[model samples]
Target: MLSVSWCATAQVFSPGGGTGVWRVFLDPIRPGGPFSVTAEQRIANAVDRIILKDVYFGDVWLCGGQSNMEMTVLQVINASKELTLASHYPYIRLFQAGLNKSLRELNDLAGIAVQWSVPTAEILGKGNFTSFSAVCWLFGRYLYDKLQYPIGLVESCWGGTPIEAWSSQKALSKCNLSFNVTNGDQKHEATGPQEPSVLWNAMIHPLKRMAIKGTIWYQGEANTAWHNAEYNCTFPAMIEDWRKAFHQGSEGSTEIDFPFGFVQLSTYHHRVPDDSFPWIRWHQTADFGYAPNPKMRRTFMAVAMDLGDEKSPYGVIHPRYKQEVAYRLYLGALAIAYGEAGIVFQGPFPKYFQLKNSTELRITYSQELAVLELSKDIFEIRCCTMWNYSSCKWVSAPIVDNFFNILSLSLEQCQQKVSGVRYAWKEWPCNLKKCPLYSKSSKLPAPTFIIPKNDHL
Candidate 1:
């Protein structure tokens, strides 16, 4: 028999026959704590006791995704300063799950790369792609700065893995993908961590029993290469399935519709021109081109189109400026998770577009817009004459007027009626903080978007 107590309440449980494993359920407690937990058991004539000290009851956020989420504090910009400042937040606990994969769901974690511990300079600035995650750490640190309470962050991520690897088979089915596995088949050879449901089985499944506040993800780069088309379905399916799994695992303690936050795919290659990256960004929001939409409710997004890092030592694909990324995510968490009001979590987005005439088109934004005056070719229009329908081409549309929340563009360059319009639709749209459009108050960059011929205004 084992008995556990917390907040002056006691629960008794019996260990199972062979595993000697028992579970104790506790009533919900308020979020701030540096408290302790003790488990006691009695044998024939002796007593065994285990005490866990400095335990916390605050929000526990699971940070998951690819290399961007795996990048450590040391690999980010101003690493030394960030590491030193990490010591100031003793209440922020960090845990990193070791890299592992399984063909079946796991009952417990395979390994813990970094156990729950308070942040330290050395610990924060550990290996390049191991242990502490800069975005996870900074997001928790920012939350602690505001909430002034304990914040637990768990990093369970693998680099270069697609969303399928982290999603369950049920989730994949939503996208019409079949992920099959044979039980007790040790001969199965996994191509890598990218195998579907492997990371979910070995890393995410085990942690489901633990209650979590929400999740912040930085992925979609891997999916950009392949399965990019299914992302709009797969991504939202994964979120829905994870929420269901966690809620059931926690015995309904975790919210069924917990908040989710994700960083839209950032720039990949400055010189390479492709629509894959921009398409993934749009798909990440279920093709809504923004978050918290009908398909993905209670969610938020951080746009990284303008935060391109062309000279990063690690690689241009891995932006070193994770602080800004984390800060933007933190703002979303404030509004979505913490219920903070008057929070400008998202940048200005196009509310609607109107074809003023044959030579002009006007776009109105959700908020007041500001032009950084960085690029002249951010907007493009597809035009094709009746005789040249098969030879349609996209031409640059110059901004004729940008005032308040409305932007007027000249369509005179297109000799024929414009059929499509797109903005910032490139792997690298602009230099860091130099995107042409942004929210005047929040300074957050507008997300990339495209309006097809049928939907063009």
Candidate 2:
């Protein structure tokens, strides 16, 4: 085990652990409450080896993912209100971790002491909010106010990084993921996050068994180079490994299936985008439906299909509308993590499709909702070639039944094969104002997906 030897000069805490503050690594194994350092040893007297004590017994969340997750609170378009408001929450803590590469798993975070400080307002001074993760800070602020508990955020994220970097070697091997970025070109070192297990060893492994409630991920923009089909297996494997890591070490958790939530990819226009980007969104949704373990349903997806910034001719992959993303994550956390009653967490999902006739098909969703304008949001037939696709013209699905929540589509009108039918399957489907479909109960838009197999009538 890798341990750090350091001294402390932070504020002292009261004996009873009242409304106050302390900055030190408290004994994580004690049950009754957070306790002070159990033991300490001097190292040659040159180094003051003291295991400091901190007593913030709140839930910690591992905010892990890539670029989008790295977006700061200052970047939000109308973020002044949030930035100022965030400074008031002293209970909310931030433990910022930087990027590092490792050939083997690491037992501690790289660099200086991993202190839990408020990311906003530096202890009575205005030294926070300059580096807080926008989505994460908002989520934590909301949750802290609601639950009234100390919320610690461990940000283990890197820009343009792929999911494999945060995953364990054992997990990747189990899923047959053998991509080694080290063997590839060395000149592209600054490209970020394609390498596997590097960030996990340096940033994540150090936090193992350091009690966290769950993780909130906002990534997948960088993984377009990897096979999209493989994401269905790789993503879950990563989540499972993280849960295992969180349960290892001295402060391990018994709950294997820790509640995990993620922001589904948003709409964006890139000069040269990956073909598998859209499919990755489908796989994210598919995990909720087809995970090998039923408990994986605890995994929730915050659909950003309606939040893509499409006005820009070139398109904005990183949309400034982080408030909606945070809200959706709030809804997900409220329902999935907190198990709130009478709350709507999920949007409309394809329950199943039934064949009504040879040309027409009936589509039903898991939730019931009023069918709105579909002329722009949805496409009926599959477009094979660009020339044929442009002229093919998408035929919108008409509202069939409000009670059953069905949208009727005609296969004959599309003049394409019946092998595939999907909605908002494009890389930038959210680039439009009118979303494909929405639920009456939740009002959330329909997620992007290609119907598995040929459900042709």
Candidate 3:
């Protein structure tokens, strides 16, 4: 067998795993001689070696997720227009990898497993390019346009793959997970705590010490199914490990923390009147709460609850408006990564609600309010705090008919007298009245209002 070598001097290939420069020489032509590669195989091997060498000397952006991220330009709208307008920044490169699970420790450089390429129709259709993570490409393209930097997008996603399969065996062992290391049982394997640090070992470990601004994630739909408990810790742990690995140590002894943003799973699965798996949606929503660090905790979640169409296939489990998804991601990046400081990536949420004098529900808000302009309509306040705290739902301001959208909640429908109000707290029908203005970007509704059972707020 031919053996490859890495040395400072010129490469000279030797037989039997010897340590020296690798030189391509034919083996002895005996009856049992082993240098019998077909002409096609030899050509293929030579081409792959050339590509591998090229990839060794470049930077890449790693993207991992399920099929939504894997959706392609042809699947979404304006494919022709988008391709015609595709003038890629030369330095901004793109790479993709298979989303295979590894029971064993992956190579240190898992993140840089593929070669970078320019965005051309031919390049995109080369391998499994149609399944490349589209959201990542859109985000990178946008960044390249605005910043004019050398951006590299690495698509490391698989269609219909669960988050557990992508995790590391070592990490999963800590979480008490079990899955067949062999025999390809994805379903049986996904039932356990995902192998922890698998992505780090395969994707992040390889790129450790590589200078990257930050990472943007668009996954967790699989984790939403049955691994909520494990995800609670695994998600946070993954963020920390990535931080430590890519840490450049800029802020004194404290390593410089980078912004890690993610796309919020949209509300396409809302099947009202049927309460099956409601907890899954809730867990997906909670993932929005995870941030990288206390300092650069610059994490944003784009709410896609209203963006999805009801007619879209629920059985498919894939979001149809992928371009919109990418745009929403870009919105978060612009606000958090680029620091626009002007827009709200999602709607405002109610912090706490209170009953006042046993009469009306007093709802209070947290942080800065963005869509209060929508509240200018009736200018009149409702007397009831419309909230659904039992299931952790979001409530949008209620609008009445084409005239007035309800602003505040002051209700008299509690065991005692209700004193606070909320909006969009339950799974309800859409009322365009809920939102008034045509937001230039994604509009997040206010939070659920909370009322103390005892005192007034």
Among these predicted structures, which one has the highest lDDT?
1
* Cα misplacement distance, residue 118 of candidate 3 (Å): 0.5
Residue 77 shift from truth in candidate 2, angstroms: 3.1
Candidate 3 per-residue lDDT, tens place, 1-457, comes to 3322231223343455455532243322212111223211133246323212222222234566666677665555565666554554455567766444444545444333345566764444333335445577777777766665466677766555555555545445546765545545454544222443344456445444445555666666666555755664555555555565456322222135556666655443454542222233333334233222242366655544444455544332455566666666666677776688775565544455544465344444444443434342222223333354343322232332221221243332333323223333223222322433223243554322223233434
In order of lDDT, best first, we have 1, 2, 3
Tens-digit per-residue lDDT, 1-457, candidate 2: 1132232223343566364532344444322223344333233454344453554567777787876777776655575766677668877878777667776677766653235775553321232222557788778877887887677777777777777777877877777876455565333332444677778878888777576778899988776665467777778888888887777652455256778989888866543334476788867655443221363557777778677664522227677677778777877888777889887776777777776665666777778865665453355555333344343433444343344577676555544444456777667654443575777887777777665344342
Q: Can you rank all candidates by TM-score, best first?
A: 1, 2, 3
Give candidate 3's TM-score: 0.65
lDDT of 1 by residue, 290-344 (tens): 8889999999999988888988988988999899999999999999998999999
Model 2 stretches astray by more than 4 angstroms: 1-54, 112-114, 121-130, 179-192, 270-275, 286-295, 310-315, 382-404, 414-417, 431-433, 455-457
Q: How accurate is candidate 3 locally (lDDT)?
A: 0.47
**Taking the candidates one at a time, how many backbone clashes does each contain?**
0, 4, 46
- State the C-alpha lDDT per candidate: 0.87, 0.65, 0.47
